[model samples]
Target: MDELKLGLDLGAVAEALAAGEITERQAKNASKFINQVKAVHEKPLKARLIQSDRGQFLGEAHPLDCGAWKAYRYGPEFRDGGKVFPSLEDAEQFIING
Candidate 1:
């Protein structure tokens, strides 16, 4: 996996903690901070949309089928799943624009 460019200097913080320069509490706090930073950078670069309940849109995690994209909503409602788009472009366009 390629390294994501997170602004948090996790290496220096870990090094300082290991060298006894920072307390265990400081290290723990730093770990928590780094996790937040990691989450921001770890988000998908593209083609990943957030799932919303009361929204009128489709997510980007759809599957390709017969040159068309099929979207499935996993919930108690919608027994047969969601709608289908004619192409991947249609899926992404609807995902972002809608």
Candidate 2:
């Protein structure tokens, strides 16, 4: 996997800890930094409305916590209720089609 832009390889850190190549304290520090990075990158989840070429309002696409996208038809009170797609393109397609 690609190393994080912060120059921390979390997977490598865990592996090094398991292999006794780094002290527990060092691993803990790395973990802390990783969590900080996550906090910085995290965004509040908000659904954006999808529109068709003719300006017809589709439903919404939600960014899932697991790094997937979800497209849902408009439910009562604008609730999300649909399938998850691996990419935003797929989600948009589903929103446009279904």
Candidate 3:
């Protein structure tokens, strides 16, 4: 059998959960999988980035950023073409428009 790897973004997964498309257990499973992967890679297990008041960079596409957005329950707007939106309201509008 071929071993195929799959990748999942926690923000996207949380969005699914918030939208009622996925269950809380599913989100937890995803998080567990991510933690296991990090352990294998010898990486720290954190789920949020502290963007300083000046908006400092926390590495390219850090996982904490994902967790922060997920915690904000901003997944629905994010998936509906609002990924680049500067505000959550704007993201919702984008979702309504598109």
What value does the lDDT take at residue 33 in candidate 3? 78
Highest TM-score against the true fold, candidate: 2
lDDT of each: 0.58, 0.77, 0.45
Q: On residues 1-98, what C-alpha lDDT tens digit does candidate 3 reach at each position? A: 00111353556666767888767877787767766776767866443333334665221112333332222223354343213444444433433434
Ranking of all predicted structures according to TM-score, beginning with the best and ending with the worst: 2, 1, 3
TM values, all candidates:
0.35, 0.48, 0.34
Candidate 1 Cα RMSD after full superposition onto the native fold (Å):
8.1
- Candidate 2, residue 20: how far the Cα is off, in Å: 62
User: Candidate 2 versus the native: TM-score?
Assistant: 0.48
C-alpha positional error of residue 61 in candidate 3 after TM-score superposition, expressed in Å: 35
- Ordered list by lDDT, greatest first: 2, 1, 3
lDDT of 1 by residue, 1-98 (tens): 01211347777677877889887787777777778877767873333453556764445445543666754444442365556788766655555545
Q: Mind giving the per-residue lDDT tens digits that candidate 2 earns over 4-95?
A: 32565688778878989778887888878887777766865577789989998888888888989878876562463578899888888888
Cα lDDT, model 3, residue 8: 38
Candidate 2 lDDT (Cα, 0 to 1): 0.77
